[model samples]
Target: MPIRRGSDIGSPARTRSRKKSRRLWTAGAIALSLPLGLTAAAQGNASSPFGDEPELLQYEEQFLTLYETIKDPANGYFSDEGIPYHSVETLIVEAPDHGHQTTSEAYSYLIWLEAQYGQVTGDWQPFNDSWALMEEWMIPSADEQPSNSFYDPSSPATYAPESTDPADYPAQMDPDVPVGEDPLADELSSTYGTDEIYGMHWLQDVDDTYGYGSACGGTAGDPTFINTFQRGPQESTWETVTHPSCDDFSFGGENGYLDLFTGDASYAQQWRYTNAPDADARAVQAAYWANQWASEQGNAAAVAGTVEKAAQMGDYLRYSMYDKYFKEIGDCVGPSECAAGSGKSSNHQLMSWYYAWGGALDTSAGWAWRIGASYAHFGYQNPMAAYVLSTDEALIPQSPSAGEDWGNSLDRMIEFYTWLQSAEGGIAGGATNSWEGDYGTPPAGTPTFYGMYYDEKPVYHDPPSNRWFGMQAWSMQRLAEYYYVSGDERVGPVLDKWADWVVGEVTIGEGGDFQIPAELEWSGAPDTWDPANPGDNAGLHVEVTAHSQDVGVTGSLANALSFYAAASGDTAAQETASGLLDALLANQDAQGIAVPETRGDYSRFGDEVYIPEGWSGTMPNGDVIEPGSTFSSIRSFYQEDENWPQVEAYLNGGDAPTFEYHRFWAQADIAIALATYTQLFGAEE
Candidate 1:
């Protein structure tokens, strides 16, 4: 039997028993010798794709070494069920709030990693297996979301006013507030012949560490669907109250965890999921490369099924293009005053923060809801995936309108990037149709994109969403890829300026000691968008506030520079990219390339968690949740982690904890960077 099948049409049972031969190569060993498969023919003249250049060959060896380290069971990158964890360490906290927990972002990186591996080795099994694992574990099964058939298109979801303060929630769901219709529901269901969504949920408890168990009700220890970040724009991962996606009223307060985020007359056992569109788009981006590379090797058929599934995922990702409540796009102010949308009026045509859906757990309830996000972050846009979905015949979505939608999205995204570009060449935060996430009015003279208002920080405010330099690298890498593929004149200037700015900030010191921009500070905002004659954005600018040797961001930065160099023939970009890759090679370890990080944010471990007064609950492990609870008090699991002592000391007024983290996405990014360099510029003599 095939090792795994695609989940485009239907979900499949976990097929974790399949095994592939593993290559065992030490990082130190590979540095001294050529990678196993390279031959003289593979290293021919500059015209050859895989050149014999010593630096390129060394990068290939580095790629193989990182690949083996990631795949080696002893390295602990993968869980028992083959799902990749967010990071190898357990006590760390970031977007997912826990190191063991995984996100769709990590799954997408795994797919990208395997795709590069396939390109290098001509073996597609690992690529297929990674997608299968993502589908089996990250995407919820039919049983997990059994009532999607009950979803209504005309009325998507009730309006719940969002507040920046966590204390102000349980936001009441107001039925009187008008919401617009879902434009894609009927077509998507009809195209697939199933009401179920063919997308992965944004987050998952990979080890079932929170004890959410399976759909409806099941045992713990299996990978389970989970969610966080409910309170609003100001709610960071630190303030979130984690809960199961499939709440059965078995944990939390009387209404499970629902009442904590949204309030209604009553509540029922339910299942819900949020889709991070950027991650799904990246998976499609990876699949496009996989198909191109596989076809080059006369092995296109090996990954055809998975590519189809990626297209299916892209089809559903259209939900991210619409307004949160389908409100008419552009200058939508006031909740009731903002006219509800019809057809495509609500479409933002740019990738938003998230789209979500849910339904009652009871089979007979016949009620479900879906919602799109109103905020569009520049960092999440992927024109490369949009190009693939709109143009690739075999990879185009099945829905009749998907091609048109993605085509529009591709154009809109480029316009968005152009509009948001700052004087310093970095992209600004984003724009939103609903100001303050509630259709509130923006300050006077705030610039707008189409109808959406410019926001210095789009989604969350605790840590400004665009403050991380990693976002610039990730988004620009996609733009670079699109440029490499299309050579579109619109993208060339954006890449030129961005490459110059980022390359200026990168410092590759001797012996792999280097620093790239870490935290960024933005000043000024782009002028209102004018597609016919775009503004220079002379007033908008960015400053590098801090710098660090972030391994993952370095890899992504190198990837972006290489792609830009490949298309534009920028020697500066090409040299800097090669330098960054070479510097990273000096930091390799048994698990992966990484650097020590002093987590000063660990002090937030003691930060208070705002629970409603007179309301209390217990976690599955019997941790208490009440008004006085702090973040560390909730789960009580972190104290048991091997790295807990350092965090505990930091929480108890000691120096901040330092950890050498081996994040799955970081390892994958490093490997992909090496492979990308080999493919893009390796042939150069």
Candidate 2:
């Protein structure tokens, strides 16, 4: 059952004032307190331990203040086990359904946040601790996946046809469908001396809100691995049927949730986990920065252990590059027609949506499965992580082929960006080996990346994955970072065009008000790739259909501009980044910077969840699941949320409810952006 509002069920909430006057030190006060030489440094005369400008000192103060707020026990940003929650507020919903439910994305941000902290304060303990916390809680232990030793390289997983509609499931598992070999399994196991994967699972019910207990039979209140979004592209978070990652007959209907998603003659109690490669890659990116900053501070040994672990994670992340079921890549019209791949033929050399592994709970059953994703989104590629994993000796993977694979991936990723770059500078959606997620035929004239078909929105389509402006900011920020570090000539022109377009969309008004691109509209598609003579993609374009002061995206945009400006010496990008940081600083609350979000999507609370007729189940909380059940009806605990009253009112003819959510990822992004600005452009100019 969900923990009741105001109950002392999880972390204790302490009272914190929203006012900043009590927490932050004024610039005048900071200047007055500094010694003679430090005061001169503040006046832009000489460098101090922080920096040589008052603005830089101010940014450092802002970062420290924000970091403290995030770390404060009263804020409830973290669980008792030291794992960060998705948000401080428990009554919100987004990609993770419940705010208490944590994601690997949040953990990656935590790692990055601490790395920035280490850079600013010359303290690496927090950075190391953050990585340790993620490893301990997010990554499944060996015991949680004991049957991995039974996995076979020859056959990965049985094939199931993917559908756009939730009603089309339970997709039948067809063993007759051919699958390719798992080339990395034996090598990875041999290198690590363990069959178990070292990657973090994408989602976790940190407070056991769903009462699924824990993986491999632990009690409630422990962090429980869970999953959603299994139906298909059309299935939104509202349409999901939440189920434990480690399925036993103890919860849900007979056969657990397996029968609800995939139709098989029988079901087994099993453990499954999915890795969001972008998140793991972000963690590695953070490690690379942490190593760089610590080495600068003469504290390289402090983060050495965590950096090594990040390399190992990157090695395992290679799974995300392969086609789902390891099917041969490119130009396949049917599931069976697509030949099973023997080795690297299945590898896309780009980060895809996810890679998953699973096995039976009863080890004696001796069956396990692994599969990679076929779709590659432009937003998921992290060239910085790829560069570090491939080139940085301190962070190179232990596996022999891992570095070479990443080196190839880095080149492929850059080329992918070039291929997808729109006439207006925005990157378009990505390519898929198995079109429509099941090797379906693409319409004639649909552009191809290598042999793969281009998709306007590769993964989820509930909102069209590329429809949000955040994707541009997040992906381009990594590109900007790569350009900053590598100074690659090919990257400069791409960054110049993108940074110009982004700055054109931004509008910083008087006072603290600002507008950045929010919703986006896309038209036209890129021309088919010819690597020897790449197409100009002049027909592809993106339009900013909406604008808002979304603090998180603004932070990301600011960070992107900071790196681009630092590398290209663009004063416009630098000034715009400064303005954004200043705007964000003005919007501070007790928890972190946030703007009020009107959740019009809450109307989907009453949306019907498609359950087959005569098929029934019970949630762990005892809510009945049947054909008539709505999204909120099956997860009745949501009704117990303190904010549910407003949602109920909205459902009963009231206005849409609004919330100022202090999401962990958003707060960390904002804080890290501040530190980034100081590091890059905070010098006296």
Candidate 3:
């Protein structure tokens, strides 16, 4: 049975505050002591934290209120389903299946908050309540099916919808509508449309391509692949969009990775669909911490069970994912084996990379020809994998009998990192030997899909993939954690290299703004705001710009760098983080509510529209132009309209802004960073 609120069962004996001096930091003191170029109203300072103790208390209270507001009381987690406001009051979820990470972050923050209170007041009340949350919501009971447990099985793979018929998708009101050139038909289908195990409840209306393009849901003109049946086995689903070569794997298995995806092929696909290792890494990390909490209470069973879960996740990441790739595909081969431009670690670098199942098939192995044609490793997914492995050796567990010892796991990470370090002092997110430059005459015996040979050079490989600063921030954070846990001096240099790059490339100057670079080059870059415009380095920083700068992405990096600076004594890294936090605070909406506006990277609904293809012309005032515009120059609704402020008003003690585009991550990341900063630096000293 699910644990209920007010239940005394999980509460630990309460104690008085351990460190009275640290109990509360006044915001007023922080405002006075803050260094130059820093904003007093942003996050609090390390010394005395948030200027006033009440501000910090208020921050916590507001967070809890928002958490309770958005949480699905039924399941005891934040709901990503339905309209954006209906779910979280702002920011609609483009893919509900992918929204679990945001919810996981929410829970993680709650635990952090409770832990903070526990450290400060010696009060176990908040800690006990938060721990109860995990038991009541995260853990699956004995009678519960593994599928019912939100935390047990990994994320379900998402499929492009196959139906275009309006009648078949009655769940979506106004299904047959069109947004400009893009038809709403593709929005109605799903990659899981053929699967029986997944019902309509699993597919949210906003799941399709965030309401863009015909390829989002299914083929616009083709009807052969329309989703007609729902209650069938694995055989009913289309393994590939058009490929006959795709084979089916046995549906059920004891393997975590296999079982999570294949056990129900009706709900599974040939490939893993999710991106970013944050969810997977954070889930295991939370489990580790939960085990620590359980151990403190002498709950041996809970401790063991949580550890086992964490280790299992590690096994899947290590053996099935990271290790398997490294062993099978070493870094790089000679030109005869690899493409022309292939280097030492190019092939084996990005262990965290992943694309949706059959996405490679859908794109016809568009980028990487030899290996990448089959595997579309992403840059954002692996740092957390490194984090999980480096978190604890117990979390590492024993490898398969045939597999090597646990130390090799860290060794693998070192190898991956060596490949990650670029000449420019930054870490690139992904690298592939798919291009002719990566591999000349493709390896023999390569698999074929959709009547296309994986050996041929594809147009997608001509221009190499660019690094993502957001992902690098994740890597930097992971590196910090790794240093903290392992106490390995080696990681410090790595941190310096990446941190230096961030300071030099991403930051405007010593006390200026932080900008995330777009994936494309100068002319083809995504549209975003440039703080340095009209100054010394005016006109959009293309080579060193990001899609958008927000608290979630930037604050995450700040937290990680803070940890690194603490561990490594890197003052430059610390200074950079301070500047970043200042920038984050300075970007708040009218209500002192800070968050990231949508950045232009992939989708362009609220961020930036593709010039002539999606829109055209300038405003009557010539202040805004659509076509031939860089992401920095384009104006978006997020920049102009979004500010709806119920949560902000409640938390910050002010009225809600008129606009609305809420992102829980922004709040969570900032809170996490602030808490970490307070813990590390807050004191009477």
- Report how far residue 680 has shifted in candidate 2, in Å: 0.7
* Over 4 Å off, model 1: 1-53
Clashes by residue pair, model 2? none
lDDT of 3 at 672: 55
lDDT of 3 by residue, 472-568 (tens): 5655676666565456665667676667766665553222245754343322211121223211212212356435554566777778876666565
User: What does the lDDT come to for candidate 1?
Assistant: 0.83
> Model 1, 1-685: lDDT tens per residue?
0000000100000112211322312111112122333333323323332245465666776788788889899999889998899999877788887888888999999999999888778889999999999988888899888988988899888888777788888887788889999999999988989999888898888888887785366766888888888777777777778888888888898888788888778887888888888899999999998898788779899999999999999999999999989999999999999999999999999999888888878888668888888989998999999998999997789999999999999999999999999998999999999898789989999999997999999878878888999999999999988887787888989889999999899887667789999998999889999888888999999999999999998999999997787677687887788778878888877788888999898888878889999889998899998998988899688888999998888777889989999999998998999888776644423
The per-model lDDT (C-alpha) reads 0.83, 0.83, 0.34
Model 1 pairs in collision = 43-52, 330-451
- Across 146-220, the per-residue lDDT of candidate 2 in tens digits comes to 888998989888888888878988887788888899999998999999999999898899999989984357887
| Candidate 2: segments with Cα more than 4 A from true spot | 1-53
